[model samples]
Target: MDIHFYKISISGIVQGVGFRPFVYNLAYKHNCIGEVYNDADGVLIKLGCKDIEVFLDELQALAPPLAKITKITQETIEPFERSDFVIRQSHDANSSTTILSPDIAMCDACKKELFDPTSKRYKYPFINCTHCGVRYSIIKNLPYDRINTAMGVFMMCDACKKEYEDPTSRMFHAQPIGCNDCGVKTFLHVNTTTIQKDTLYHTAELLKEGKLGAIKAVGGFHLVCDATDENTVQKLRQNKHRPTKPLAILVKDFAMAKKYGVFSEKEKEVLLSKEAPIVLVKKNRSDLASAIAPGIDKVGIMVASNPLHLLLFEYIDTPLVATSANLSGEPIITTKEDIEQKLPFVDFILDYNREIINAIDDSVVQVVDEKLCILRLARGYAPLHLKLPKKIDEKVLALGANQKASVAIAFEDNLILSPYIADLDTIESIEHFQSMIANFKRFYNFDFDVVLHDSHPAYESTKIAQTFDTKKVAITHHKAHLLSVMTEPSECVSFVFDGTGLGEDGELWGGEVFVAKERKYHFKPLVLLGGEKAIKECYRVALSKLFEVYPLDEVMELELDVVKRYKSKIPLLYHLFQSKKNLKTSSVGRLFDMVASIVGVLHEQTYEGEAGLRTEALVGTLTREKRFEFTIQEGVIDIAFDFFASDFVERFYATLCSIVITLAKQEEKKVLFSGGVWQNKTLLEFVISELQKENIPYTFNTIVPINDSGISVGQIMEYING
Candidate 1:
């Protein structure tokens, strides 16, 4: 009896990831005689087995682990007299364009060739085949062939063509295959001329000569320099207009990272993961320069991934502050024209002519208990959407904000959390977000049914949602925060704190206490603002409160100048707290801001969380750990602020000092230190000292982040149950 054969098409992140090879092996093992090919939509599989049931079971059940089989469709046809299974050249189904995958990190074989001087790709910055090299940034269309990519101009030579045609070879069907004969070249621009075309070695010399240059990294443009040189770093900071925000330092490898930051097993793994993300690591007292990460005790660091970075390290002995080549709070520009126009301050530009289809900023992460703490997921990690734990029936798309942004895609019940971070805080960022989402929809052939947006109504993200012609669900900013956390239902006293998030009441909210069970929550906003000026001025607010109680004018009968005369920092507080533009805020972050400002720890903040960070650093050094007394009466936990104001700041000049003294004399108390404010080292030191004197035990976040990033995960859990 004659049997019919079946042809199948599968799509969604199926290519480059060993999918075709896996299917070839599967078809061969199953005794099927049909061919598999790559098309616009995923992989195409064919089956012509005599025993249909066995062939179907084996093919369907034993798919590759990484292959995300989104949809599968098959058509039955007359069987061909084929003897063996093979990977035929890809056939064009004339399908829609596909999303470009990221450049995977160098595999073991590539890493081996990198050090071998005899290898063709030795010290080659753009060494890649299918396994690694630029993907999403280089591709403009689907079926992911070289003709559809930026590398199309560089044709394959005899050696590469041989490997590519040989089915038994690793490079078989590898689209990005390139050789020295036809590969990307680098040129150094000294002034207006593109000089130093011969080698990457001379580029290092120019950098050493105090020349500010732009380096074309594998995924994007990077501003490189010797981190040990104080002047070089300071100059970049001034030029980049990023003086206060700490720059991430890139080391040669994991071994070199040991010199500056403390890394556990989890941190090391994340540093070397395929994504090759930058992780925040705690600095040892004697490690690298204090100025590297200025206000905070922790520094962001990453090991070099691109081969060019490795080559640069060979010429220079010290680590480089390998930050993105762009202005502060701006998107990293990739095109040459943009480089010249935007980075006029740069001394030279090392550039190549290639089109970047998509822009992915660097991924930034932190380590917790040797595991990755994702702060910003970009580059090697973007477009890799996070799978939702729960399935929802509504077709929903969330337009997250530009800062700490994330878009949630819901289909039926399955949702996708598209990896993203805060945009560069500009009108262009909002436009980019809208454009990317439109692209995401086109790429997946899916449209938003009911859209969910943050309640920050004035935000660009919210505005984008309104533009969409779909049902809208405006999730409160804080609710999104709570829902993002606790993906599962659980009863817990949750403390959500951060820089700022829009709350249900149309005010910037961050510090919050909640009794949560699934999506059901009763939230109480902490740190009330006295008026418009108290927005971020935490210290000024406290001073205002103290004045109300102490009656400053009566305390010392003198001119209004007398209150301003002590130069006690109270005058500035008055001006700040009473200022019209200061704005009102009931956030815990602002509360810490006030404390840090008042305690003489920080007068002005250069970055969003700098004041809190400096204060925490100081606390870590010498903490008396004085546990403040409070009472939980009638559903409300009330603490007396009278001591902090009337007695503490008025009659006594040093309340923090007194708190330290009190804690130092105690013993055996269990001290709990948390909130984003605890990220301050100095406050932690004080808390630690007091706890130690009293023999108090303490635990900092290991399973959970001590920052607002984790607050959303908690929020997720709280809402998931509902």
Candidate 2:
């Protein structure tokens, strides 16, 4: 029989997902002799086979569960004499094209081995296989070899080495594979004492006893305490200085999660997915500490995604508040020393020997209108990879907005977005942003040809663009927000609503409607008294809007609590309002704040989006057919406020939906929604329902975040389209 030799190259998430072993086994089944190895580009296979088409078809169809093969190419190659198939060493190239796999949840196979008494890795906290465990978090360079990871410091044991070298073994070529004898070790630090034995048990005990502990996991550290303990939860909030901000909880499994939150089928699937993000679901029971979510009716719940968390659950059945260990508006803590120095209130610390080279927080997602909406993209959901329609010659870097910062790099046909970096208001967050940029550059061997940033002149990201020794492009904030949801270059109508962004006219714009690239409509601008301070102290925004319709005496005579609470400060604010020296904004996000304040849901926000969240929570199952009166004339939409309405918040949501539907009807174009305001689940669902009822086509971000975390992707898209 005649033999054919073919060179096959496959790209995308193929490096650390057991692609080589799957290929090697598949080759044998197909009666082919081949050698498979990873290269800078992806997995490369040299196959000597009788039927090439059959082999290639099965190669794609029977790929490993975790492998995501984006592109595959085959070509005729010279045949080499070989007795049998083999797995070859990885090849390093100056430039890398391989996508790094995100850190995955602990697989069932690993979990089984972890608990089975007969298994060698029984009770091992760091048990992992080719199917799961650390990936992007531990990796330092490309080709994804064991030597290029944080695990390279530990030498494998004899048994582990044997398993890693065996072609048929599940752990064959698993870069992070190790047995207990040669794996990373856990340490528990309490006061001046260090305890190495039974650390998980000790940590669990502390949590059960209502003591706060910082425990390191696959990505970073989490400040953990018993979720069912009200005082403990309150203590954690006090220590973190996170009053009223909902804390995410880690449960043992779906059953436990179901007890605390009502999970739909889609939410359940996302909770059990390999990415294993924190899913926001409606609260189902009151057994959890009231302080865990505060005023919100929904809870952020996640299943144990790592062996350490799973094993800790074995010691304690109570759910734990597993919030990221970090200061407000800063990056998640990675090192034990940093955790010790920063989180001094923690009673104990659980740490491991392996280094976390790339620290990321848990990704958060929600099911809106029965579709997945990413709120925060990190950990398993990043570095996000998107394919370009065509390869570009210029390598571009996009620095996202100042808040919810993320960076993206576009090289050739690949666009990689970094994990979410928190708000860049702090020095720590800015450094983290710089580190993310450096990591992406090193991963792709990238020297950017151009840098893109938001048009806001004072934005840290925009200022960072000035230091870059390349061509810099400024994309208007709302335009970038619209572009993030555009899959193709086509004329469409988009609603870009958020808290604050610099507009082309130098005013603060957060509520905007765009027909194609033209700003065709906007919400009537309102004065933001006290400027930036009004965002945190939202009562100022409410008072300013009230001032628009009512004179000073009429406003003061109103029975609104906000008016009463800030009675003394009103004179100075009214003076500022009269002078018109404050910033003017057309922000729907601020509108939510205004409504929330007027209705007494929230007056001041301790965290971003607090007022909006509280307002949504207060609406509960109430629905009102009544909408506040709104008029659109000459490309502007103006609302008449009836702040005294019994169901004002519900009516406010209804009116916003009415506005969007009216605009869609007028333009007769597909409606697209973007920006942080779209993260409001209640508002998004209401608008989606209205659009469907009217038989209007509408879409919002489902892959990337609808929030500002997606700004980097939009910036890159804007650059490409422009």
Candidate 3:
């Protein structure tokens, strides 16, 4: 009687996820007896007798990559006599309710059973059995046992019970298993009133009919709507108070997707990948609806991540604009009660209380070539921390901006980018951030004595950091933008660009240029005479500058007269311009804004990025016979030297006035448009034409992200060297 022992430790997202059952099947396959249980660290296992080395080797090799093996301690020991393998109760001693991974949509295996007519879970919207489905949502505490989850309600039926007990079944010990007969189910409930529609077609009908509705999705509530129908789309947008910003479109399949936007092979592959994100694709050439993206040319599209989403498109067979259910800047709605209260503003509520343990908005991405570039990383790829390239001296916690919020941490020189959660002001997001910091601390047991935050001193993330006694470092706005360039191996003068950041002299900074390295950066900001104050003063400086320049013709001479005509509407703009001290910035974002405002494209912004959005769109109309000349003067400092040749303000006022005078909807061409604003096709094409003769090496956001979201990587780089 040879007593042999095998010790196993599981890692990654294995603890709360169903790794134990997977282990059981493997043990059964190898004809070995083992006992598996959960621990604070991860999964602990003991296998007994016969050929243990080969079995352990195989199990470790086959372990899922998602299951990160941070550290595995294995030892040979005497095996305890056991007839079969069993998943024992969790060890209660160190059950830290650590933050778990964000919920993922159902996998194909589960989707098959869900939609198959012959299966017990046929048509089950919430038919997940641990291989893939909502996990973090249902969990109330760590250890992830059924009693600790939202699934504690609905008792299991006979079939589900047997499946849960069967080690061979996929649902073996799955905490969130079952269907309408024995598990969670959906009902068409609006304003707390339950409806009788059991099928998705009927539900879609109510949605198409403009009935206010709420959909309880994997992570939270989605206020879904008909996108193709202009009236329906308008109604939802109006009700949500979201007027200008483009709403994301959720399509059925890749084929229907072609109807709205164009995708290259690179874009298509990224779209179909497991981490399904709402990808921003360019519109080919069509009259789908001006209202879809309003002033922009790009559309955010996502496929069905779950069975319910698949069924949704089949019923309507139409494109749907699926946005998070919440007021502007609020967290996504996650509960049925949230729907009941918010449904009056909507038409109906589609939800099931399967328990949402975590909150995540739709993740959005884009592909330039073969590599996928993340625009907004959430859902399928969040809370999954990335390892840093080198070790650092101190642990620094980074509190990112208020919107598209993500908190970062540096431990042992590895940087972990947290997932985006809405509203830093809310207790939920703040609490989530704080708890996540602690969760990482406990797992790695790192030295967390230092803190780093955005220089926006007023951010909620910074206010929270005040409670900690850690040494803190403040990263400047543009410097961080420059740093994003350092993360990649390529070295270039970072044309750090975006919409907003506090300038060094305490004014808004956007567009910028920086020659960067890991340690330091030389930056130049694109600013007005008094920074934003000048712009607010109706660009009095712009008018003054334009008047002083020798006029090429009377078309340019109209500048001062133009300033006087708008006095009634722009009294403040003139004041801010004259009163402020020397304004300076190396901001490219503001450069675009100034151009847009000068162009009179979006004088009064309705949203956060009105100027940028409009400018990019306006560029498309131009036939570029020539390109503008931009040069670096006095070292790396960039100046609009050629722009000095023209009284741009006069030209701007003249052109805009002419357009109104002529009752024309569009305008003429100018400069090479790139950066995020290029996302607007109108501006993209316009810039190409006006500067056509220059024929500069024109490029838009291809492999690189054109939006402000890319600034995080820039932040990481600047901080490392700065």
Q: Best candidate, TM-score-wise?
A: 2
* lDDT for residue 211 in candidate 2, whole number 0-100: 92
lDDT of 2 at 254: 91
- In the range 1-722, model 1's lDDT, one tens digit per residue, is 44568887775667766667667766767667878877766677777866766765665677644345655677887777888888877766533323346666666566677778897777766666546656767765566677777877877888888877765666666677765566677777777676645557787787677666788876568887777777877888888888778888888888788888887887778888877888877885444545578876777888778777777777766677778887766666777678788888777778766666666677777654333445665667666543456665555566754355656554532344444534536765566666667666754566667776667777667788788887876666655554454332133333344566776656766655443422122122343334533544454545554454455444234233323333476555545544544444445566556555545555445666776666555542222223334343433333345333322222121233233233323322332333454444344444455545556454444323344433333333333444
Give the better candidate number (2 or 3) by TM-score. Answer: 2
Model 1 score (lDDT) = 0.60
lDDT of 3 at 348: 73
- Residue ranges of candidate 1 with Cα displaced over 4 Å: 1-12, 29-31, 39-41, 50-81, 88-100, 285-290, 390-394, 412-414, 419-424, 490-493, 517-550, 553-584, 621-625, 633-722
Per-residue lDDT for 202 in model 3? 69
Q: After superposition, how far is residue 141 of candidate 2 from its true place, in Å?
A: 0.8
Error of 2 at 289 (Å): 1.8
The total number of steric clashes, by the backbone 3 Å criterion, in model 2 comes to: 0
**Which candidate, 1 or 3, would have the higher TM-score against the true structure?**
1
667 in model 2: Cα distance from truth in Å? 1.0
lDDT of 3 by residue, 1-722 (tens): 45477787654467645678878888888777878987655688888757767776776788643454554667877647788878888765433322354566677788778778889888877777766766655666666678878888879999899999987787888788887688776777655577655657767887677554667777788878777677777877787777877888888889888788899887887777666778888876554546778876688888887778887766787777788888666678788776666546776777765767667777877664344656566777766445556666766667665545666665554455665665565675667666656655654445557676677778776677677787776676666655543344233333344556665657666544433232122124433654544443434434434323333243243444434455453444434434644565544445555565555444445565566566554543232222333333443333332333234433332232222211111112111112343343343343333334343332334322344443444455556655
Q: Provide the lowest-lDDT 10-residue window in model 3.
A: 663-672
